[model samples]
Target: MDGIHINENLMRRIVRSIDKAIADDIPQYLREHYKETNNAIIQLRGDYINENLRNLVVGGDIEFVPFKRYVWQGRIIVDRAEKITYTITTQKTLRAVPRKQRDKPHFLQTLLYIENGGYEAPVKQMTLMDLFPFEAEALENDYNSIVEGLIDPAEGYRHYVIAYDAEGSELRDVQLEFLDKDFNIIETASLNEYIKPDFARLTDVEPVDEDFNDETDGEAKGLVTIKSGLRPKLRDVQKQA
Candidate 1:
């Protein structure tokens, strides 16, 4: 568990393995484009160590910046008219607590894309886990099979909407309204406005417990108990295993 004891060579090997897996799993269209570029499939690779660890007496604590071992970049021609460049970043970390009492490292990936000349706005981004079934499964299972699970592309799209609606984002003014079965408005809010302190205060004071008649509270209590009581023991058992 000591970060100082981390094997840089092992980490590098793991990164290379994942990179190869990603390259091998790439779609034929993307691979053809990559071949056209004549550039290495993996364009960049680096390690990140926690700088704060230097100031502490316990110097073993370290964190990989970007939270991943390496990053890859390349371009793909979607059609004869347009070419899209993409960056893929990966993370491999030893989790303090692992799922199902399995003490395996966690793997995560992010994908970003932009047109060659379209830099006016930020790059379109999504998690690899949020892609369509074939792509998502390919990326998730590419390496050592440590991925947690797949997330629906719809969820990723919702996340993009929320992020884009934040202050300073292009869609800040976009409002989303939730409706009930009868078409009655259940809630209406803008993402940026919803995060304001005033908005939080207003929403926090709602009589949620009264509205749900203790059912919500009971569910919350159950969740809290599971988190506090079962989670740590599972982690400990995982470590032992």
Candidate 2:
């Protein structure tokens, strides 16, 4: 990907349009890529910002922060009220979780921080809800079979849901919301310490667990749980040179 230096001109045009102060969770890299514009791939970052901005504004809403580029499926969540607007940058803000994997807790924590360390009760009580077909076949002996469905349903079949919580969090405390066919709403179970610069440095994003049946419940443990698939890790990014 070394050949992939971002086009600078696009970044300028795009940056001039977004609300960066409120969208701090958005990576600054977008400002670089948005220096130019592409007509063909409007859904590309350029298009996303423009489209999201256009749609939100048409509905009498406005962007409180600048637009950002997301390497994942889910990115920003906008909430507005009379005379005031704010943006929530969630964990999915990084990119996306691997197939069947999710980035809920991290997203929630990020949202909480962006909202000043406290969120509405509805946002706080949310949890991860899976959309993939649930089956028992893909499960590692049904460790959480009762509350969660199997990874696959048929014998040697798998249809299921798998959720991971922060060290001090729990499954029962979480609330679920049906956002749509493709997306599920996850509310934070509660509030915790706000993330500071030191805590940000402590961000230890881990690698995706390639082995689904590693007898370890598909967790690599200790990762931020939300990461970019298209981008390299800091170490990996530096080593490319």
Candidate 3:
């Protein structure tokens, strides 16, 4: 039941995991396979991220569960120790907005915010329990079993949105948006600085070996050219993973 705060160190780990997936893994997969639809690409990105997070992050209190306990397609992270839960969602824009067009909250996301009183008041498990008064005990047990890492109500509930822009098969930026009771963005933290540089394509470079020794005798050997389908390198080059 501690005050809610953003753990920068933990956030860094999440950012690094995402950076590797979107920048290195996905692009390479696309290069090696046929093109995928936008929806399929989104799912692939989420799977790669969750897999990376499970591997790179170490913690017993962290749990991956579907948002609202039923939306498997919208899986999210629940950190019991931190008393904060967040979901990594995608957006076309660099900034993550709660609403569809920046004016209204998405229906599913709104349900979560409303259930927590939109941060205006502390959430109470009793309030939820009261709804199923006829079968409180049984329902509580079921809910507990379903939500393995429910945030302690006494600690109060805090929700954050981790939004990333991965348009055009490249990650343009990543950010954390803090929201108030009205779903307005109260603050933001950009994690782009922590993202590793983009991977560079090795193209048209001659081999380091100067001599190509062969039984061809005096036959001349021309320079060998290596071809790649990846785009040219930018000024800030990233090491291949």
**Top lDDT: which candidate number?**
3
- TM of each candidate vs. truth: 0.18, 0.21, 0.59
Q: Write the per-residue lDDT of candidate 2 for residues 1-241, one digit (tens) a residue.
A: 1011111221222222232211222233344445454232222332344444443232222222332224433222222222212222223322242233433333322222222222122232223323432233323232222213311112221111112222111111111121211233322222112111222322432321322122211112122221112223333644654
Instruction: Provide the lDDT at 187 for model 2.
Output: 28
Quote the lDDT for 239 in model 1.
63
lDDT pick, better of 2 and 3:
3
* Model 1 lDDT per residue over 164-218, tens place: 1211111122232222211122343333332222212122212112122211100
Off by over 4 Å in 2: 1-49, 55-61, 67-109, 116-241
Model 3, residue 72: distance off in Å is 4.4
Order candidates by TM-score, high to low.
3, 2, 1
lDDT of 3 at 84: 63
lDDT of 1: 0.21
Using TM-score, give the best candidate's number.
Answer: 3
lDDT order of candidates, top first: 3, 2, 1
